[model samples]
Structure formats: C-alpha cells, structure tokens
Target: MVEIDESHTSLPVLAFFRSPQAGRSWVTAAGLVLDTANLLFSALDVPRSRQVELTFTAGCLAVNRVQRFFDKKAETQPTELRTPEEVAAANPGREAFAKVWQELRDGGLPVRPDEEAAWQHYQALRMRYAPSIEFLSQLLLAPAMGSLH
Candidate 1:
C-alpha cells in the first residue's frame, strides 16, 4: 500500500484510513474533497489550474454527501451541500434501514421488511448513490491504472 502524508492529501483522505478496518487488503484509495485555491499555497507539486479547480468542486459535493451519510451531527455545514436528487434516490435505502432498525417502543419480534422489499430498497439506494462510489473508486485507482499523469 502506498503511504501518503497530510502534505499530499486532504481531510477526507485521512478519514478513509480512520474508518473501520474489518478486512485487510493490499489496495486502498483516497477520495478527497479538495480546495482548488489552497493547492497554490499548500502543495507545490500539485497542479493549480481551472480543470483542477472544477474537479475539486465536484469532489467537494461528492464528499459532502458522504459526510452526511457518516455523520448525523447537526451543525452549520458547507454551502456546497448534497443535491436533492441524491437524497431522493437514497431514501429507499434509508427507509429500508429504518424498517430494520432495532429500536422499538413496544418490542415484539422486531420488524423486518420482506426480503424482496429490502432488496429493492437497497438496490435503489445503491444505484442512485453509485456515482459517489465511482468517484472515490476512480480517485484511488487512477494511479494504479497508470491513468494519472
């Protein structure tokens, strides 16, 4: 695995490492929500250009969705937040999760959605939120695939 420090990466990159490590693998990737303007001041080796800026903006949006997924905390968030489309698409998965959640007021056998319902809800969410996954995946794979110049 390639080791990169703060100098070479961003906060979202660090968060990926701090995340749960259930299985070990030789491969890992960093999906960063980067700052375009900061690159000029921080990483001298990194590019400072319009395309880089735009890419970073897109990364910011993707990571924001990811952040809201992982963090339920209420606070003043970045103005560049997740789009309505993202939320709508992921709602089925959210509803499926809500149905299966262990929380109960008057407990019984515990509510469980039917297998087909669960599967459909989950698939909907996954398909909708897949771009975020793809973005992060490509970010990590680019160097390995020799697509990064």
Candidate 2:
C-alpha cells in the first residue's frame, strides 16, 4: 500500500490517484501516477526526485489496493476501467514510463536516493516561503504556489 507520508512533491498525485473516482478504477489511476512521475523525473532535478520515487511507489501501491474493493462493490456490471497494461500500452510517454511501471509491477522500481544537499535546498525554499504562506492563510487566501519541490 502507498505510504501516506510521502514526499511533498508527489503528495498531490498520490492523493488524486488513491481517491475512488467514478468510472476509473485502480488500474487507470496507477498509470496516471506513473505518467506524472515520468514527467517530473524527466523535467525536474532542481527539486530532486526523492519525493517522486517515494510517492510513485507509494501511490502505485495504494492504487493496487483499490481493485478488489471495486470489484466486490459491483451490483451488476463491474466498472470496466482499463487495466494497467492497457493504459500503459496506449499512453504517449510510454517510452519512458512503461518500463518503470512494468518494473513496478514486479517490484522493480529503482530507488534513486535524493542528494542530501539538494533536498535541503528545497526545504530551505519552503522555509523561506513559510511567512508568506502563513500570511495568506491568515488572510483566508491561498498563497501563490512555487516550485519549492
């Protein structure tokens, strides 16, 4: 199952896929998580991918748990959500994500440890923005988001 306490960068992805969506089952959601991970892993090194790997593994694991619950709850036709294989096969970024997600299925997702200094840089950015975030919260406003991660 997904570790609920995953890194902040991937937290939103984890949160979204883990939720029970209408029409979509665990299968499709898991792929979406991978696609997002592939995107992040490909683009962002400034924030490091620690949370990326952590949350990807955690998110995939969480989605995995939803299938049985989905199947058991069916009244007539069980939700015909696409399988992970189907989703992976059809996605545009399959070149990268497919290998990873498939490996994930067999406990093959590689763990790339985030550099300690790089992680601290993101933490430092968040700390620097803390007051601004607090001010927005105090005003009942959402602060502008940054790429702290």
The per-prediction tally of clashing pairs is 0, 0
The TM-score, computed over Cα atoms with residue i paired to residue i, of candidate 2 is: 0.30
Candidate 1 local lDDT, 4-111, one digit each (tens):
322223444443443355432112232312311222212232344776555545544454455444344323233323355533432334343343333321244333
Whole-model Cα lDDT of every candidate shown, in order: 0.35, 0.37
TM-score of each: 0.26, 0.30
Give me the runs in candidate 1 sitting further than 4 Å from their true place: 1-61, 64-111, 142-149
Give the deviation of candidate 1 from the true structure as CA RMSD. 19.0
TM-score (C-alpha) between model 1 and the true structure: 0.26
- Clash count (model 1, backbone only): 0
Quote the lDDT for 93 in model 1. Answer: 46
Which candidate achieves the best lDDT against the true structure?
A: 2
